[model samples]
Structure formats: structure tokens, C-alpha cells
Target: MAEFWERYAEININDRQRKVLNKLLVADPDDFEGGISNKKHISMTNASSATATRDLKTPVETRMLVQSGGGRKARYGIDWVGITS
Candidate 1:
């Protein structure tokens, strides 16, 4: 996981994005269905809801994170295979 994180550093992600990814990496796979939400991100990163939303987008777009649900109920989880492979 450390190696994977180190590899990601070359990309243009922000500190919040890195923090979110680290959280996802350690989270249980069973919890992924109802995974981390934007509100959680806001709390974790101490950023605004809008900032959390934007921070999440880059990982989703890059396929490092997988998004589910929609709107206020949206949740996110790490793409394990995408990261490990």
C-alpha cells in the first residue's frame, strides 16, 4: 500500500485526495458498499463540502476510486485491483 501511494504521488492529486485514498486503503472491503461519503470527507479533511466533492472527482476520474449511489447519498471506495495491479 505504501508503494502504491508513493506511485500516486507523481500524479496531480491534492493533500485531501491523498488522505481520502489512505483512509480507503485501510477500510474493510465489506464496508465499501456503504463506503465513505462526502460528509465524511469534509470531517476528515476539515474542508468544505464543495472542496470534498471536487477532491473526490479526481480519484474517480482517474479510476483510483469507485463511486456508487448518487447525490447526497453518494459513497466512494478504493479500486483495489486498479491500485494493486
Candidate 2:
């Protein structure tokens, strides 16, 4: 939605965050997790594990991404309503 994009554009997301967000946006719901881990982000962005972790943090804080689990088991997904509202 244009509203969502506008709000997203106002955020201070970096390249990694943008990439991860795009992946999550287009991912099939069934394949969303694939497993609760940051490896998905690392593989998608070719980023280091630490970089992926940091990249994900801003989205979570801004409610663009919802995070669950803990540590290496953590997972992330798009917050559809959060963004579009």
C-alpha cells in the first residue's frame, strides 16, 4: 500500500533491513519461517550474522517486523497490519 510505503520510507532503515523486509513481504506464509533462525537473513543478504541481527533490530522496533523466539532460534516476519495501518 502507498501508505505503508510512505511510512516505511520515513524510517531509517538501511540496505540490509530493506532487503530483509522485501524478502519477508514476498515470502509465502507457509515458508515464512523455514526454521526460526537468522540464517535466512544472512543467506538472503550475504551479510554476517551480526549484521543481520543489527539490521533486524530497527524493523522490530518500528513494528515493521515482528520477532519471536530467542537467540539462535529467533525468527522474524512482516507485520502486515502494523505497516498498513
The number of the candidate with the highest lDDT is 1
Over 1-85, each residue of candidate 2 has an lDDT whose tens digit, in order, gives 4566677787888877776776666667677754325888888888898898888888889888778888877887777775543
Per-residue error (Å), model 2, residue 9: 2.1
TM-score of 2: 0.81
Q: Show where candidate 1 strays beyond 4 Å.
A: 6-9, 28-33, 82-85
lDDT of 1 at 74: 92
Candidate 1 residues 2-51, lDDT tens each?
75676566678988888888877876777544788999899899999899
Worst 10 residues of 2 by lDDT: 28-37
lDDT of each: 0.82, 0.74
Give per-model CA RMSD.
Answer: 2.3, 2.4
User: Global CA lDDT of candidate 2, please?
Assistant: 0.74
